[model samples]
Target: SVCHANSIRAEQAETFVADRLKEIVQLPEVLPRLVAALNEEIVRQSQPLEQELVVLLERKEELKTKIEKWEAALEDSPELFPMLKDRLDELTEKRRQLHIRENEILGIFQQGEPIQVKDVQRILTSLDRFLAQSEKKQIKALYRTFIEKITFDPNHKEM
Candidate 1:
């Protein structure tokens, strides 16, 4: 009798769960946007590239200021001339390299496209391989556009 009662209770619980699940599934209001967000793909944009370009330009400006200060210091004290000249040369070379890199990033933006799922995954897998230096910000910004929100559905246990 105990076993029979337990079996009946189990069957009732299963039936109740089944009915509740059907009710939740039939409710269209609950699952649309969440499903859309999960299914939607991501695309690349220019904000990230522009962000890096801004940084590079700022660094180049700072380098110019540093070089100018060193030049002024050298004129004030010829005894420190050789060291200051070396530093200015290093700063000038660094600024030149930044200029070259900014141009490269601009080139990448010129060749833009609507990136898909595979492309996003590939970029995520090897961010460094996709871009270099300040362009890492670009990669991060691109990835952010993906999965911007995680909408949970308890009924389906999905995004």
Candidate 2:
């Protein structure tokens, strides 16, 4: 009895599916060729993203090689040691300034004011100016310190 009931349900499901397919086939505006064309376009659009990823991977490899070469050069030059040290010190100072600015910005965000596009632009411009000035000062200091170190070194070879 159970097998007979299951067969009847299966027959009803097959009839329903056939009816739906017939309705779809009878539709006037649905074109299989257009659907296939749209699907092909979607596939074509996705292909460029794969190409972009490959380009990015190649760029990353190039940058890695450049960075490794720079590191090796720095290691081979003893004069670069003190210059790098000064640069690191300058970076630390700039980072401290940035931290203060970040905290101020966070406080502003916490104040619940509606930030407009102009406000964001103004803030970004101000930050850029401040960082540029700070970087200039840091570079000047670094150069001065490097020059002083070079002059003070007893064993320094004039180049």
Candidate 3:
């Protein structure tokens, strides 16, 4: 019955962690601090996306300018059209790719909401309620939502 024993141990550990979390979340200062940390994490994570979007926009603009100039030159001199067409096509394709990436980043930003105190409270409340339920799937999902990693030391039987 090793599997059954292991399952029992896992349930016990989850319940212990849930109890600890519930106790910690009840404190007056914890909500604000949790919200601040979540917000900080959101900003920290978004910085690269924001920077990349900016760079993409700028590069797209530069490519637009270059493309316009090439089109104008091609129009002004039909003799050079064959030579300029390849570079113009390249700039257009690059711009198109940048636009696609910019939209993807924007989509991600649009999907995320800024974390607020009430959001944390609501989550804590859900945790409180869900922990009382007997569903392991929900409990595990809730844990995953808040816990980034869990380090278990089997030698010492510690989590």
Candidate 4:
């Protein structure tokens, strides 16, 4: 009796989750606009970083030129070697800083490829069919694939 009751409760839970998911996946109409907005936002945010990376790369090249000049003069003007070395060190540090900043900006630009609406609709349709016909084990596996946890409110008898 205990096992039967537990089995019935599990079935009910599976139905509840599947029904909720089906309701949520009815977003084929809105998904395109939502995806476009997300992509536009990403591009807008990354545009500044892209421009800054270009500037940093240009500055890095300038620093490299100065460091090269210092290195060349350091060999020829031993008398001013100390001053030349100091300048070279400063230029090298500036170049390093530019490199670090370039990397940071590039990281910000490294967003994942945008999701296509058709792919999402296809997957949602498949999921709807799966949920409609899945056995308990298959339902559990489906839940595991898409969900991390499910919290229920006892007072409301809802998850």
Candidate 5:
């Protein structure tokens, strides 16, 4: 399976990737349709992660409210406040960690920008036919840059 994904089963991934590439790079004629399709796919893939993030955010808010109550109660009992202080610190750290995890989950849904000019050139070159070895290399590198990974299901014989 470590070859050009030219097989019938790979058609879906190929079409999805190619159409998404076209849409992202803004090929005007195919723009709207492909972009909408990619957006739908993105939303579908991100939904579960998004839900998890929402839950985490709600927990964070709950923790914040609890910490505020602890801080307010600190004025009433300086003797008992150390225990509450420690709990507050623990909850604050947990909330911070949760926020970081939420951001990491959200990062999965982000659109990546090419950091190099050559990557852009590679993308543009891949959109056209090229006979030269240099151009071929560029196209090959471009394909790898996207890290086209295919998953195979042995039980069902599908990808």
Candidate 6:
């Protein structure tokens, strides 16, 4: 179950990374350091969740082993055995709850969709506003540089 949860979380994290990379296309300056920073953040957020799942699975296994030992010892004392059984039942319940939560979180991760068009439009609008506020000469130079990068086919209608 932990393995499954980790897998789902990884997928969600990758999707987030891809979305961010796509958004980077709009930025005028493509800083390698900024790209690396974003990648680091994605890994940082996902790694802790993966570690937590590993710990949960290990603890669950340990609890199961302890419960088995207690059960075996209880066969000798019927009265003492019931108390041990109750404790085991409590531990089992806790494990069950953990499993349910893990599965739910995993399901949410798997079901998550990419950011909507509205979100992209909002981001682009913000960027446009920022660019508009810059000096006209600078903006024109930037625009000309971008325009000069393309080669128009002579057969096509001239702009």
- Which portions of model 2 miss their true places by more than 4 Å? 1-35, 78-159
Candidates ranked, most accurate by lDDT first: 3, 4, 5, 1, 6, 2
Per-residue lDDT over 26-118 for candidate 2, one digit per residue giving the tens place of the 0 to 100 score:
453443544556557656765565565556556546555655565676789967866676555554555455455545544544553333434
Question: Which lDDT values do the candidates have, in the order given?
Answer: 0.59, 0.48, 0.79, 0.74, 0.65, 0.58
Could you arrange the candidates by TM-score from highest to lowest? 3, 4, 5, 6, 1, 2
In lDDT terms, which candidate is top? 3
Q: Which of the numbered candidates is closest to the native, going by highest TM-score? A: 3
Cα TM-score per model:
0.41, 0.30, 0.74, 0.56, 0.53, 0.42
**Model 5 residue pairs with clashes:** none
RMSD (Å) of each candidate, 1 decimal: 15.6, 34.4, 3.9, 6.4, 8.0, 17.1
lDDT (C-alpha) at residue 41 in model 2: 67
lDDT of 2 at 93: 58
Question: Tens digits of per-residue lDDT for model 1 on 51-116?
Answer: 889999999899989988888888889899776777788898999999899889878766654434
Clashes of 5: 0
Lowest-lDDT window of 10 residues in candidate 4?
1-10
* Between candidates 1 and 4, the TM-score winner: 4
Model 5: residue 16 alpha-carbon error in angstroms: 17
Candidate 6 per-residue lDDT, tens place, 13-81, comes to 333433444556456354344545655666666666777777877887887787777777777677896
| Ranking 3 against 6 by TM-score, winner | 3
What's the true lDDT of residue 88 in model 4?
76
- Kindly indicate the candidate among 1 and 4 with the higher lDDT: 4
Model 4 local distance difference test score = 0.74
Error of 5 at 139 (Å): 4.8
Clashes of each: 0, 0, 0, 0, 0, 0
Model 4, 1-159: lDDT tens digits are 111432336656667777766765785556677668877887787778878888889989999988888888877887898666767777899899999998877776665467677787778788888767878777788787777655665556544
